[model samples]
Target: MKQLKILVIDDEKLIRWSLEKHLSAKGYQAIGAESGEEGIKIFEQNHPEIVLVDNKLPGIQGLEVIKKIKSLDEEAVIVFMTAYGSIETAVEAMKSGATEYINKPFAFEEVEVILDNIKNKLKIIKEIQVLKRQQKDIVTFDHIIGESVQFKQIVHLARKIARTKTTTILLLGESGTGKDMFAHAIHNDSTRHDKPFITINCSSLPETLLESELFGHEKGAFTDAKQMKKGLFELAEGGTVFLDEIGEINAATQIKLLGVLENRVVRRIGGTQSIPVDIRIIAATNRDLKRAIDDKSFREDLYYRLKVFQIILPPLRERRDDIPLIANHFITHYNSQFQKNVSHLNEGVRAMFLEYNWPGNIRELRNVIERAVILETMTSLQPDNLPNEMIGKIEQADNSSKENYTQGNIGTSGSIVEFNIPNEGFSLYEIEKQLIIHALKKSDNNQTRTSKMLGISRDTLRYKMKKYKL
Candidate 1:
């Protein structure tokens, strides 16, 4: 660990010498300055972690020095050293930004205890900074996996908009279509990527609490608000604030949000001061805001404010061509997570995946693949390894389609024949052979036409012919 550097600003020579001697002996690097001006100069030169300022300095007062130091470094930790008669001055110094105050003629043991407490607070602050950096690293654009045409188009647009620092982005999509992931990607790719990226689900909290969470509150603002707190907007200053399920926020909150978007300033609950914030707002929702506006549930002006640059994420069913790629990506991910060696999905599994309509979008597909990867005991994922509900849904769809075809209701021209199975359970192989024979006879033994009619590849048709001895 690095040694903590301290600056002591005192007019008295004995106080400065004694503090420097005791602190240096305790493994702290202490620098002494006579008067507040000299102390401010030393603070700028060395940038000490802690400052001990005497309230009754000769030239510049301790409160003025505290204000100057705070202006230089807002996070600078300061402690005021005051005489017994100057307790009110010390309090004024604290109001000016000094972290703590110590009385005159105090024991060295009390100073030691104060220094120890300051060290602990400094450690916690450092840890929080490290965690914020880690969070920024984790939410980068590289984590979003997709190569489909629609997905790539959305990603390209996101990357393009991410270069702008002040643009408001709206992500419109279904519940599980990865809107949150897109929000993260936009933030991590933006100019403010290194700063805090705060997220809050607008629907998750009550109206009063949501307002407090978004706009923050002063100490004693409410019954439970025992201390002052910074809201998501303040915490995400110089970065991004992601508001998920934004449609769920009430009308009053929506009006406040519009003011932030317009003025870039937020007022804390029960606080008169309006704090300016530099942040990009990314709001996402599954609900239709236009319909909500028509229903008078959501404000039209707020909706337009949020939709400055909107990206609508397509559902998974609309992008079926990307399923195999996404499924394999999830398979590889889960293989490492579960320590399994499952390689790929079987042909039947792939066919079933293609036939099913994924109502829950990419999230549902990921969950299904994760479950299959965990349960698979073989080298590949099979149809039997899929969830029973999924298999049943596919079977029901097939049955419905077959029934529609038999009733001559499947096609616009109504030219297809009704195919019925016997009650005794006919052989599937025999049925396939008869269908191929009839196709060949109808096509006058022309392999191309026979293959076309049978809806099979020419190679598959030839293989079946040889196997059936036809």
Candidate 2:
């Protein structure tokens, strides 16, 4: 936090001394100047938070000083002091950008009141600036860049439900598929846009703590419960409560949550009274809740209640057409963030992105782009800028398509593998699995050599092996 600095400019030494003394005692860093010209020089050097100027001064008037200060910094707060008590002069001072005008021979209490009001106004302006930044920083639906048919349908459905009075919404997706971002977009577009939007991860805390965090607790409810506290449900009021990792909550908590969803009310852990809450519950999870229900971990009734408005996000692999759009969006984002002029990805780099399976989804792509932008020196994103895993995938794709490639397999005027399209069709997965096996056998089951030969990262190779049960 910065110290509040006040510049007191008065031709009378006694007035300047008195104000400086009083302000300094009140924790303000106050400076004194004998003339308008001197005050302006001090202001230019120190940039005080508040300026106090006497109307009648040598060389320049207080109104002129306020205009000069305002010109230097438009947001400068200025106080005009005058014993002349001329309403016209006060109006002129205000027009010249003096924040407040004080008549001289006034009590210190009056001056204090004015100063307090000015401080409050400045605090409010600062808070509004922070709030505006936060609101703009939110990942709204507009920020979700997608163009594939699957991606478009999901976004379209989400937008429709966002404006509805839906009590419960369940967002299902793999990890890093923007489930939380969707929740934010829904709340921002809803009727409770101006209200608080609180979010909590269900799996972050233990069951006891999690329950207390959601519904709050009465005073002395636990060893650490010293004061009566409001939970996220009560705090949100008519806003929204986003429960991420909804599948991770235990069955007991699920029942309580279901009751809340079914009755629009929540009860504190130690309190018997059911408090009515008008908040929307937006639950998201990367886990397979349907499977959890079959395993008797998640409540079936709770699942249905939360599934009133369901949204299933398509993974990046399923929306290959949107990869370029998303990648370009990340390029633009990183360009601004890293202060680099990354205009676009090169043709080969774009091909690699399109061919590679983004198992980590958008978040993985974002991290890749961020790293590349920081490392890349040229304006365009080139092959060298991509992660090794993606580079390996590029190699794998090239090896599969190129002719006369004889790294391990020997064939004349033909590639390592050849395939004929059957009328019944071919399985791409089987083709990929066979390629991995061939590489492994050629390397004598050496993972590192196999990864290098196949042109994929070792980690990716291992993941593929597990995926194919090799």
Candidate 3:
């Protein structure tokens, strides 16, 4: 066992001697001082882990001593021993940084219990600090926060793939499902963060200029070509180029991209020379690439090439277990940005957030929190600050499903349920089943329309269908 060091300070010789004897007998190295001034000097020299100071002391008061000790070592634990009928003084002692405010004439057993509690707390804090330090080594997982088993499995998979030089990684998910964030994580975690990470929105850009923008245009290549320009591929040499909305690329553009992917070279439009390039490719699509391939809207060969390392990000609704963590993360970020001291979410707000299907996925949730933080005061964010559309839904849910409703949408019957168990409670399966059934009933069972209304991955809905024996 580790040796415990304690400093006992009091003007009364009997009290100081008694404490020293009892603590020493309890296997502690005890130091006694007659006054607060002497106690401070003894503490400075001894560097004791714990201090027991009398509230009434000669020269300096116990609270002042605690403040001084705090200024010197913020982690130092000080227990203020005050006489009876000084409850107010004890509270003041606590506010001044004393670890515990105990009445004088207390029994040794009570003091011993308090010391044990403090020791346990300190042990937990030390473990937590060590864990935090270990986390500093992690670069990508910091942004992806979740205690859910599924999310953890995803992180585990991502970390393994990130260490490799995989060229094609197709991130499939719904819009606002954090595909872009995961793309950034993959790029940063990979061996190519030092190089440029160029992103192209195939759906956003015009097809006419997409080729030139991707492969560059030479001087006098076209009407607006005043000077030579490097395309995203050339600029991303020895790095990664993220093609978002890859499903939106036309067949012609797809053929061109296929050539670049296959040959690792690009020819500037209106230029004869083929420029050799070295770059990794990461593409994302909210659209079903397989469906596009089946429809002949996308090339099957290119689809195979992009699927070398496919990662499907679950929509926010699919991973409802992650909502609390994600919500807290956004709340922290918004609180800091908006300069609000708001530290916690009300139970009602949390309940509503978890219950609602985030159609926009993570993006939608982040936007809602950001908006609420900006618009609402430091006081509890009432349901009003939420999206106006959601308010109606929440109201309806509240009315019909008296258990589930917090004044939102058309509440379906039997929507409200509580879960509690010894250590283990409700399974994610049960909650998700209930939510889906409610959403379907609410949306009249239109799968496509229901998916949009629920803000969940269609794949997730299908998977649940099979899981629930639908």
Clashes of 1: 0
Arranged by lDDT, best first:
1, 2, 3
Per-candidate TM-score against the hidden true structure: 0.63, 0.73, 0.56
Better of 2 and 3 by TM-score: 2
Cα lDDT computed for each candidate against the true fold = 0.87, 0.86, 0.82
User: What is the per-residue lDDT of model 1 for residues 1-470, given as tens digits with 9 covering 90 to 100?
Assistant: 59999999999999999999999999999999998899999999999999998888898988899999999999999988888887678779889998888999898898999989999999998999999998766766687777766788888888999998899999999978889988988887888888988899998999999999999999999899899998999998899999999999998899899999999999999899989999999999999889999999999989888999999999887776677888888999899999998989876687677668888998999999999999999888988778899888888987786665445463454554445656665554675677788878898999989876755445456667876899
lDDT of 2 by residue, 255-342 (tens): 8898899888889878889999999899999999889999999999999999998999888877766777888899998899889989
lDDT of 1 at 119: 95
Better of 1 and 2 by lDDT: 1
RMSD to true structure for each model, in Å:
15.8, 10.2, 18.3
CA deviation > 4 Å runs, candidate 3:
1-139, 396-470
Which residue pairs clash within candidate 1? none
The runs of at least 3 residues in candidate 1 whose Cα sits more than 4 Å from the true structure, single-residue gaps closed, are 1-137, 411-470
Cα TM-score of candidate 1? 0.63
lDDT value, residue 312 of candidate 3? 88
Off by over 4 Å in 2: 1-5, 17-31, 35-47, 54-75, 78-128, 393-470
Cα error, residue 438 of model 2, in Å, equals 27
- Judge candidate 3 at residue 221 and give its lDDT: 92
